[model samples]
Target: MSVALPACPSCQSEDVVKNGRTRHGKQNYKCRDCGRQFVENPQWRIISEETKGIIDRLLLEKLPLAGIARALQISELWLQQYVNQKYKLLEREVQVRPKPKSRLRVQMDELWSFVDHQGNKQWVWLALDAQTREIVGVHIGNRSAASAQALWQSMPPVYRQCAVIYSDFWSAYELVLPSKRHHAVGKETGKTSYIERFNCTLRQRISRLVRKTLSFSKKLDNHIGAIWLFIHHYNASLPANSSCPL
Candidate 1:
């Protein structure tokens, strides 16, 4: 009598062989066709839709991954994997109504953050539509003229051509922004108060961005993704007709 072997979980290939035992003495197998290895009869937890929805809400709040996992009774590894998948599929473009041929004012600002360690500094550049209070553009990179230019290029074409940009006296703004449409003002002038307040909101809501916090991001991609995710949620929650939806 012969017993049938389990097929490969990844490719569903039957060309599999027993490789070895896992550290916990579970049977491990390797697939010849897909070169994939997995444990036999592995216990996989199925996250319920309700649990996933709860996780989504927690992600937008000022909570750490460990705290979220603990509260949801899920493993940290699984929660991290879920978050990775969620962020990877986020839309890259900001959804907003185009106000072409109109005199629009935009507030531009840059905030500093780090990934993995303090040495790996990353600057988050943002452009906000003054009237709509929508985050119309974003670029994550070093604090340089190239990043400023990238932020400008990321804005919708109409805003880029017609919007008057108000920012601080950062030399990069002077180097990249058009002198005719750019105004570098001090904080006392109140020109950039909108973006400044939004930055404060960002730090308050995103745990990883909170100053003096131990919950800093370990990867740059996830850090940037979290910010964009919150931006989309915020724009969606605004009054109707404020912006287009993606």
Candidate 2:
């Protein structure tokens, strides 16, 4: 049986024909209508622009790049480039996310993870919108009082005024978080559970953070860059002008 293929997207005409092959031997296509040329590959099957929304949704919902490649029937590296470029460019234009009205409690916590560095595990401090279950900000570095302060400092200027800040018995949290922000600490405080579970979510969503991966992180910056991509999409999925409900 002959494999059916798509006509050129630009031309929308069957007058499309294979022009030759590239160095990679991928069939090159030419459109008679517009004289435009393209390669017919899985990457082109779904236009990158259109796939950006799907890619964003997948990332927001915590789908790993491997999972996205499998589900979308595209190359993992191709999908990675698509997402990396799309959001990186998107981030430039948008910069940091604007703080939305969040009804849920906010929580902050840091976790110790290893990299190739010759030292002990570094830390990534995350601030989460407890209700929406989205990571609002992440601070990376040593977990000193200064590092902790730096992490919490990265939140959008607005969310720094969250109604409640939940964290473990970390003394540094008490130092920087203001009184009006209600800090829940001590062993008895149940507020840390949400952020702790969020750590598990990150572990599952990102291969680099996973305990067992062929490519476990060796660089802290790469670890943090993944978090950036994760947070951008996570915030986009929520209903506009409000925190994520459900």
Candidate 3:
């Protein structure tokens, strides 16, 4: 039997002509109807948006990379690469959204997790708006003044006009945050209770952040990506009134 011609993927037209062979030797075709060029044998497969939705949901559910692969019937390596690529897109999308000009009562804290293994500790710094229950900013690095500053700087300028700021007696918080706004309070006084509860929520939602769990992150990049994904989902899931910045 003779080989059949393929229609143009963009316009679904068979009015096509041979362009040339790609460097890899696949036959390239050009569509006369849509001016679209495509290879007869594409080197890259297009992943469907439905598959991407499943991946996003699974990620928010705190499934490990291997677990996600098993659920999707794809290789872990592919999922890993896809997540790395998609997360950068998500980060850029988040960065482009307009910042709301809302004064905030912010609570800041840090939680410890490990990358590579338990011996390699990493700190996840988080800032939350007490009124909105929205995670305003996140930073991950060593537990130091620099990391605290990074978290502080990530917040929008509008959020910096806080009525009060609460944190534990971490020296980094005292150094990085403005003295007038900062309150180093004990957990007993309930000053940091909201943030403490948020930390528990994070640990419950993200398996990698849980202590003594087998589903921990092996790479720091993946750790950050996972957290970013969770934060985005969590904020979106909140009620409209609850998520307002002010």
TM-score of each: 0.81, 0.59, 0.74
Reference-based TM-score, model 2 = 0.59
What order do candidates take by TM-score, descending?
Answer: 1, 3, 2
Of 2 and 3, the candidate ranking higher by TM-score: 3
lDDT at 52 for candidate 1?
95
Instruction: After the best TM-score superposition of candidate 3, give how far the Cα of residue 10 lies from its true spot, in angstroms.
Output: 19
Of the candidates numbered 1 and 2, which has the greater TM-score value? 1
The runs of at least 3 residues in candidate 3 whose Cα sits more than 4 Å from the true structure, single-residue gaps closed, are: 1-47, 92-103, 243-246
Q: What does candidate 3 score on TM?
A: 0.74
Off by over 4 Å in 2: 1-48, 61-63, 90-106, 114-122, 129-136, 156-166, 171-184, 215-222, 235-245
lDDT of 2 by residue, 1-246 (tens): 966656887767877778898778888888888898888653445457666677766765545578888887778878767755654454411133455666447788887766774355767788877666667667767778898778667766667764477788677777787767757586456677777876887777766666555545554555566666665655565565554433
lDDT of 3 by residue, 46-113 (tens): 66889888888888875678888877777677788988887666671223133466555788899999
Please, what's the RMSD in Å of model 1? 6.7
Error of 2 at 70 (Å): 3.9
Sliding window of 10 residues with minimal summed lDDT for model 3: 92-101
Residue 123 lDDT in candidate 1: 93
Top candidate on TM-score is 1
Q: In each prediction, how many residue pairs overlap at the backbone (N, C-alpha, C within less than 3 A)? A: 0, 0, 0
Q: What is candidate 1's lDDT per residue for 63-108, written digit by digit as tens? A: 9999999898789999999899999999978988657688999999
